[model samples]
Target: MLIREWMATDVLTVDENTSMMKALHLMKENKIRRLPVMSHGKLVGIISDRDLKEASPSKATTLDVHELYYLLAEIKIKEIMTKNPITIQPDETIERAAVVMLENKVSGLPVVNGKSELVGIVTQSDIFRAFVNITGIYRGGVQFAFSLDDRPGSIKEVADTVREHGGRIVSILSSTDMAVEGTRNVYIRIRNLPQEDLENLEKTLRQKFRVIYMVKDILKTV
Candidate 1:
């Protein structure tokens, strides 16, 4: 999925000259954690709740409430915002956006167009929703996990078995990260099989492959 399809287009922003107090209020009012910092109609930096906390007076400070409020009001977002923040393009794939966020240790990203105009924002929550959609978890299917050799038709054999038993395939995901060399782990989501057929299907699959686990419902397993 592309970033444009999932990113939040109704972005909230703060100007470089915006006071820390105002920024904090903006975040609270909108129930958001981050805001893109803009200057003279151009994207310049980004600020998050952590930055606001850091800019605020420490809990142990001896300053009076009025003094603390005054200090925060005088602090501009530009002074604490991360300059030249990492960004992602709206046309980029969601996988690419996730990789960037992971590498930078950031929970969110500002989406920009080719001309560098701020278009939207993407966050960890958005990526998670994309994952749920990609895995077909919301459809509620029976899932089976297997450890199989990385040879051709290995996946097809499993798929054919499900099809033969009146099972409709929903999603198939495989990875080699946790498997022994020359073998990989596969998770297959299928639907339309009755509980009675599960026993025979499991027996048929175990004859040629190792069944790691099986779940009657994908949503519950997740």
Candidate 2:
């Protein structure tokens, strides 16, 4: 999946000179964590709720409530915002976005176009949405996992066996992360089947391949 297909287009932004008080209120009213900072219709910086909290006075401060409010209104977002923050492009893959976020220890990224304009934002929630969509978890109730040889025809052979057993494939994913050398871990999702047929299929697969596990009601909690 691509960032353009997953990022939220309708995102809230704040001006560079906007007061911290106004930014706080915007976050509260919209129930969002971050806001892109703009200057002359150009992307300049970004700020998060943590920045506001760090800029705020301590609870033990002797200053009165009115004074605290005034202080917040005087501090400009540009003063506390992250200038020239990390950004991703719309054409980038979701996997690339995830890597950027992970390496930077950030929960979200500002999506920019070729002209360096903020087009949207991608967050952890969007990443989760992409993962669930790719797994087909909501529609496919059962999943079969295996450690198969790292060869071209391995996946197709498994898929062909599934079809022979009246199984309709929903999604197929493979990874080499935890597999032994010369092998890859494969996961396949399929629609629910009758209990008897499902049992027979599992037994047959176990005999044919290195079956890791066959799970039913895979998305019961979700």
Using lDDT as the measure, the top candidate is 2
Q: RMSD per prediction, one decimal? A: 1.8, 1.2
Model 2 regions lying over 4 Å from their true place:
218-220
lDDT of 1 by residue, 94-199 (tens): 9999999999999999999999999999999999999988888667467889999999999999999878877788899999999989999999987646678877
Tell me the RMSD of model 2 versus the true structure: 1.2
TM-score of each: 0.94, 0.96
lDDT of 1 at 42: 89
- lDDT by residue (64-100, candidate 2, tens digit) is 9899889999999999999999999999999999999
- Top candidate (TM-score): 2
Which residue pairs overlap in candidate 1's backbone?
A: none
Full-model lDDT, candidate 2: 0.95
Q: Pairs clashing in candidate 2?
A: none
